[model samples]
Target: MKLLKTAAVFICLTATGCSSLNHEPSSSSPSTRSAASSEKSWWPFGGKKTAPETAAKIDEAATHAWLDAYEPRLREALKDSKFTLERRDNVLIVTAPVDSSFNPDRPGMLMPTTLGPFSRVAKLVEGDSKTGVLVLGHADTSGQAPVNRQLSQERAQAVAAIFRLSGLRRDRLLLKGVGSDMPRAANDSREGRALNRRVEIVLTPQHTLMALLAQYNTPAKAGPVLAVTQTK
Candidate 1:
């Protein structure tokens, strides 16, 4: 009887040990559960992550087409002046000499004559809700860096104010002051320095407008439509 009882106890202990080894615990610690979940969520073979919806692609062809249509109109509006218009990629850049746009005595203030051209530009762009206007002020390297930057900023602001007063949407206008950083000519000569002192009005199409243009310009059989790459 004693032998049998000892045998039975040993059997029970062995069975309990085997059961524990065969089955995991019913519940795990929070950290262990979280780690397992993370491991299951990751996949090494998955492709690159998608870009955000706001990261639209620009249609180059559409942009160029839009520029083609507006370039002549802009040139006509700014005719017979110190202002020169050029097409750089999709942007229409209207470059105006500082002498024509700003008062010599007050570098930050706009010349009275500058109003007509600026107003004309404002009127042209105001009707197009899909265009954005950038007023950029450039200064020669004659003054202190801080002073030049401030003057440039003020001039840009002055130009932007004119656009606003002429009924351009406030949200569509931006201003920047580049003081002697992007010179059009060598700054060592008087003529070169004069050339560098200028303001540029940059006109760019918004992404929504570009997309529409792409669809309109692209042939139906030309594979996928051009994607909008960037917003205004």
Candidate 2:
């Protein structure tokens, strides 16, 4: 009877130990669970990258906001000058008369009155990482074509130099001399000639409409999406 009782107790202890071993989870299982959780967080099934068009939209919106913020102030500052500031196709066009901004005969000299306007322009466009300046010089039909072109280019270069001195990036300045080629007015009369002999400063965003999309794009978060199950 004593040997049988001892055998029964031994069997009961062995059965209980095996039951606990089967029910308790393995230590490696938690690590596997952790890895799965990490994977789900990083790449959920519903996760999607930001589309190129979306990025472009953000770029457009940001560009517009910056322009709208500065346009009114610019218009107010340049209200009385021969310079006219207008927005066209998402660019700021500053039309300044050559007579007002520079010497009549001196291609490299800027007029005394031009300092004030130049300061205002520099203040508005300088230090903007997203902005670039295109300086175009025009001439009246009074001079030889090649001579006018050279003179116009020199004048444009002169203005661009001032912009460079005003803390603008040298790479952002584009200089061109369209000498009597792109006249806002016909060069027949005195008034028309004055208009034709002018410098046009075009301020454009550094990024193109499509390129901006990527620059300003944001990706969606990879979170789980909830779905309800229908039951009969």
- The model with the greatest TM-score is 1
Q: Per-model C-alpha lDDT, please?
A: 0.59, 0.54
Which portions of model 1 miss their true places by more than 4 Å?
Answer: 1-55, 208-232
- Tell me the TM-score of each prediction against the true structure: 0.65, 0.60
- Residue-wise C-alpha lDDT for candidate 2, range 1-232, written one tens digit per residue: 6545533433343223222112213442323423332222111112232223432223556768867976887787687777888776466678877777765565456665565676578767786677766666678889877667656655666566556556776445555555555566667899988887877776667554223222212123211111101000
Candidate with top lDDT is 1
In candidate 2, how many Å is residue 164 off?
0.5
lDDT of 1 by residue, 1-232 (tens): 6545533433343223222111223453323422332122111112321212343567778877888888888888888777888776557778888876776776666665566777788888998887877666678889876566546655666666656655776556655555665677788999988988888787888553322223212233222111212322
> What is the C-alpha RMSD, rounded to one decimal, of candidate 1?
29.0
